[model samples]
Target: MGALELLPPDTAAVLREAAARTAGVTGLVVNIAVGYGGRREIADAVKQLLRAEADKGKSIEEIIESLDVDQIADHLYTKGQPDPDLVIRTSGEQRIGGFLLWQSIHSEFYFCEAYWPDFRRVDFLRALRAYSERNRRYGT
Candidate 1:
């Protein structure tokens, strides 16, 4: 996901390093969501779906009639990927601040006081531990 949605100043190098280190790990999928805003993601998804529909020559009324979560999801940037099970926010932030708006309906969160650069192995371990202890209802 390097330089995927970034403009300027955001570290593409860091994203490249991460992708290089984690490429084809053969385990759980990780989404960086870098240079992303939740509303922006949703808008992008919607636009993509609309474009596809238009290409198919579907009328506006027909497209609206058939629009659905799955339809929109298929056009999302993270299409075909499972939604996040856990989201960790660094830099002492307490909120997701619009990370995975549509996809993370039932996700768990782990907030850390350490900033992204300062976040360490121990901090990651603690976040994992926290996630392990949560009682997930998945919208019950």
Candidate 2:
């Protein structure tokens, strides 16, 4: 499991410990967001990117010239992971509400009327089926 660094130090420590304990386990990586906000995450990523480039002795103009979507993505919390292909919004909410803003640029969405606690395996299957039926153009 992975989480944003914005959590309290004690909570962050617990998350780290959990990660260390699970490092050897294979498959089924679950990423949980704690005290996470997509806008804040993007802002934090940009801050880290600027700090890294500055430490590398790159001038502002040089950094600006070299910056790209991938560079920004590399600094994001979910770096090195593939973007989510399908996002199922529960609680009858049709909107994503700022979830995975940068990473979900091309994601497919499925809004369900049931609340998350009421969601079941059958609902998940339906979501998967819906995803399979789409001709995923990935923004063209």
Best candidate (score: TM-score): 1
**Which regions of candidate 2 deviate over 4 angstroms?**
1-30
> What are the per-residue Cα lDDT tens digits for candidate 2 across 1-140?
34536667787788789989998988554555666789988998999999999999999999999999888999998897889888888888888888889988898999988887699999988998999999999999
Predictions in order: lDDT? 0.85, 0.85
Q: What lDDT, from 0 to 1, does candidate 2 have?
A: 0.85
What would the per-residue lDDT of candidate 1 be over residues 1-140, giving only the tens digit for each residue? 53454644356666677789887687688776566788988998999899999999999999999999999888777887889999889988888899888988999989999988788999999999999998999999
Q: What TM-score does each of the candidates earn?
A: 0.87, 0.79
Q: Model 1, stretches more than 4 Å misplaced? A: 2-11
| Count of clashes in candidate 2 | 0
Candidate 2 residue pairs that clash: none
RMSD for all candidates, in order, please: 2.4, 3.8
- Scored against the true structure, residue 83 in model 2 reaches a CA lDDT of 90
Minimum summed lDDT over a 10-residue window in model 2 is located at 27-36
